[model samples]
Target: MPKEKSLVKNVMYKSLLSLFNIVVPIIIGSYATKIIGKDGMGEVFYADTIYQYFLIFGAFGIYNYGLREISRIRDNKEKLKQLFSSLFILGVASNIIVLLAYAGFIFFNYKGTSSFSIFAIYLFSIFSNLFYVEWANEALEKYDFITIKTIIVKLIYIVALLTLVKTPEDYLIYAGLISVALFLNNIISFVFIVKDIGFTLKCLTFRRHVKYLIMALIMANGNVLYTQLDKLFLGSNLGKDTVAFYTTPQNVVYMINAFIMSVVYVTIPRLSNILAANDEKAYLKLLNKVAKSLSLFLFPAAMGLTVLAREIILLYAKPEFLPAVPVLQIFTIYMITLAFESILSNQVMYVKKREKVLICFIICCGLFNLIAKIGLTKAGLLTPVTAVMTTVMANIILISLEFFYSTRVLKVDIPIFKLDKFKYLFISLLFIPITYGVKMIFASTVMITLVTMILCGSVYFGILLVTKDEVVIAILNKFLKRA
Candidate 1:
């Protein structure tokens, strides 16, 4: 039954969600950036990062653990109910501790800053995760439900951002709008979850879930360092302007990476079930499909970013963020590394209970990033651009170690990287010179970026179309045949 849950259909719905996630952020952020200016954007994200630390503690890796565990036992209603209740209790307990700690930090350390009050308000997000049953829906492969609900919330968020955040001083209003959307999204998802499974607190056991919870916490901690800590370090050392410059480009890359990873994420629960069933043939087949899918999407996505980095930044934020070009370019590599890392880590390593190995690798990278970021900042070497470079290097190392573990140590003995990947890479690379030529011929600007993206993207796919690239062809046939 789990295998029968169409991966293609899940990917389609998740892609819709990903598209909304990407486009809405860019559109709202472009407006928000212009309205709030760099300093205002910086203040919001800075406070938001502080809140993220609390969020990490509150979430306690329960989402991932819950998805994996629940998917494994999804057919058994009683077990699924008990697991959900236990995870819920664990999440609630953690959120309380995180909330108090957050309040104390804000009062003691950040009380004087303009963003402190905003950060205080944003602290309510700690409980949002408890109301968000995304992990359960994901485990149950409820993409249609998740996608529709998320689209509605994001559409409302876009309208709210457009209407409420009209001026520079509306920064807190902007933050509030975002917070409201976050809470509303989680609460709505929770409502749908209740409709599906109903509410039950009976027969919950925290002790049984404790081992995975601790492991999840460690994984979440290691991950938070690179993702959220980058902004904090940038803000502390270089101020809000630098945070804006670095985060602006980083946001584009993050959205692109998020889109690609959506499919990988949608597959993880299925992979967990397949692994549990010990169906190596099906497991390896799934792995190859994921690899090809990443190649098909990531190559053009990452390469195009590198090619049009300047146009993208200027169009996405404004000329004020022109300094983020190099940051965006360097982050393209990070996007690629992170894509493979998620597939290997979640689909292979995490499924095999290789959390210890992942934990060790992730911690080393996190520590390295911490030391490098702080050291570079203190040494006056880590500008927003250089700081991004540092983050990319850390990601490269992290993925390298994980890839080694997946292939050598675990010896999963499946072709994680297929030859077809080179075809995609080569085809994606072909867009660079053509796009660059267009830019040189027609002076670079927002128009040039849009045209080049359209022209080059069409050509890139044209070649793939001609060659009948299996991934491209498969996807096209699937959609076009239905049409």
Candidate 2:
């Protein structure tokens, strides 16, 4: 069904899905923060982070590896069925091992701890992840089905959260709600798999995938080491309240990054196909378009978050989390770096078979992040700001390495810098003062955030239109002509 859909239609579905992902978290975070306060929220996130580590073992980089592999052979139903069965089986075996290890770690290290029960509740998400059929759906570009399923499950989760979670003491109930939602979403997604792709292990051998899967696992390790390690470091050292303060701001930036990624992610399968066919011309064209578009969207988003950090915190979190303002401000820079890194890493590098390069970049960045975060925190720096600054620095290193290798080393022929990017950046920067000027007039947190986004976003596009920026004009002409 998705194969028959136009790219625009597929992207619209995916964009809706991404929007829901962003909105649901904000809504839950906002409500949960009020009910649980900073410490309670932090406790949940800390446990969630630990669960994420075990999750890495179960996920086994299937989200990336399986998607690329499945997309490559999607036209062949037998191969698709065999590959899916092998991957799913591998995930199940790995999840069982990891889950046992996780239980042991919690029992030995965290027995009778305040957050131990929450951690146990979150561990069930590992099973949910193992049963995930998302990679196969994504490979088929079945975004409409995927989007609708997620929205339905998420809506139910939201309703359940609003109805069941009522007070600070209800943190475990909140955690259970998420765990149940995850399990149901995966179970429901698999029902379509049997109908759409069928289930069998007749000819599949997990041993055939051992090498590539190990490589994927290594890449996942490097990735999680940097991304989730900060939370782990903060939670272990600074306590849950500090983790909560840091997590709130980080979540906002993550939400923005998710939205920016909605466009870039849908290109990976196409890019994989182009790379497979060695269509250098097509690859370059797509890369240039993506680079410019990411610049256009992420620059203003980063700036907006940076300028409105305090307002955003006030809106999403309580006054107790006012200290997160600086953390949010520093982490805003990550919005730009992460946009480029994600596109280059996922859409370009992985598509072009540069897994080793990605591994190198990720490992190097992870080591830098670990060292910097540990050293800074030991020197009496708080976990929130210290971790944010170091993570930003690590990303800068990663994106820089990725660009260097993709251009000079690999000779991909994609522009790493363009004059139009400068124009886009210059125009996007104008929004800060324009938004701040609007923000000064509004005392209410919600009013300032809403008005600033609307007016500043309007002005940003208006300037692009006035300048007749090529990307802006092209996008406008495409939509206008389509209409």
Candidate 3:
């Protein structure tokens, strides 16, 4: 067997993948928004929000469960094949059922509308997902392959977007392009996964996996309550334009959060492997390392987003999207909250097999989010700003609960309050004034954002270097050696 790659290498590859994911959307969205206008963009994303709910049901928590399970047995070929076959078959069966239900809903409710045509195009995603086994590759730590495949697919997607989507009436074609990209991504992964673990149905047993799958399903839906349901509520209450206002900034926040969480994500399989071997010491050590690294980046990122929320909106969206500026600013809190949440839930709780406890926390928080949004809408107060505020509050509650449960009840020694982390936070706070100074000097939106990012990044890391931060020094040393 080959030796495993270092965590740093995996993280580097994963970060590249996240960066590409970020860049492609920025490119497509920047152009798409200008071309299609807010209503068109809103309509496309609103349909996507509805599609995401059904996608979650069809998925049935398979990706998370499969990633953990496959990581455990990846070295054992027969076991890997057995588990892969069972999960793949199970996913297909569930997706088919969900697809039929989705079709019926579209026919009953959305038929004869533009959204109906969009929904029809999106049905390809459901069919494509039958072969969506990228979780298998992620479990095996194939970030290199995953990264390359995604870059190639997205390049093709961008070309299609630029060529095919020329006018607002082509929004349906835009939606089709997205579904096709997804289809290509999944199909490519399905073709490549056979080399790692070939499919076999001989040893399949569905009964054993059902309980965990159900729990995962519930937890996933609970997650969607806050994440996607906000758009649904906004679209229904305000309009597609409002959904555009809310979604535009939130997507930016999500992109930044994805990049930060890439560190936490690449470690899941490793963390699971360590826990499965009962190495508490190594697990805790690695967990602290991840927390420190996240703090180093998350605080500054949150600060930057809060400080330059206006400039960011100007850069990626039109003047009508300025309403989303405050929404994006408020989402700074959500982004920070979500980064730590990933550590506690994905790293600590899920890796340690405490899914039931985690599930309860998610359900409670999700319910709070749902009820709060509904009450606000009923009271005639659910604007984009209030909607985001509700989400931030819900996430804060969820993360707080997760931290308490993980540290207090589970007796996990998460050093969240370490002084070094606070040092990073304090240094990050300096960006507020520095960014203000830069903005006062530069009237151009492009210059203000560019200079603020460069100045903030340099100062942030320069301070870390001055303080002799080990993580910074280590990463610098690696780059210097490569140079």
Query: Which residue pairs clash within candidate 2?
Result: none
> In candidate 3, residue 415 scores what lDDT?
72
- TM-scores for all candidates: the values are 0.96, 0.95, 0.98
Model 3 segments beyond 4 Å from truth?
A: 1-3
- For lDDT, the strongest prediction is 3
Global Cα RMSD, each model:
1.6, 1.8, 1.2
Model 2 poorest 10 in a row by lDDT: 1-10
For residues 1-483, could you state the per-residue lDDT of candidate 2 as single tens digits? 444556666667888888888898888878888888887788788888888778877777777888888877777889889999889888888888888889898999888978689878866887677688788888889888889999999999999999998989998999999899999989888888868998896998777687777777777566476658888888878787888887888888888788777778887776776676778898889878878877888788888888888888887878999999998998888777777788778876887777877887898888889888778877878467878778888999888888888888877765646777767778777777877687668888888888888888898999888878887887788789889
lDDT (Cα) of model 3: 0.88
Shift in Å, residue 404, candidate 1: 2.0
The candidate that achieves the highest TM-score relative to the unseen native structure: 3
Q: Is candidate 2 or candidate 3 better by TM-score?
A: 3
Candidate 1, residues 10-50: lDDT per residue as tens digits? 99899889988999888888889988988888888778777
Query: After TM-score superposition, what is the CA distance of residue 470 in candidate 3 from its true location, in Å?
Result: 1.2
> In terms of TM-score, how similar is model 2 to the real structure?
0.95
Which 10 residues in a row give candidate 3 its minimum summed lDDT?
A: 1-10
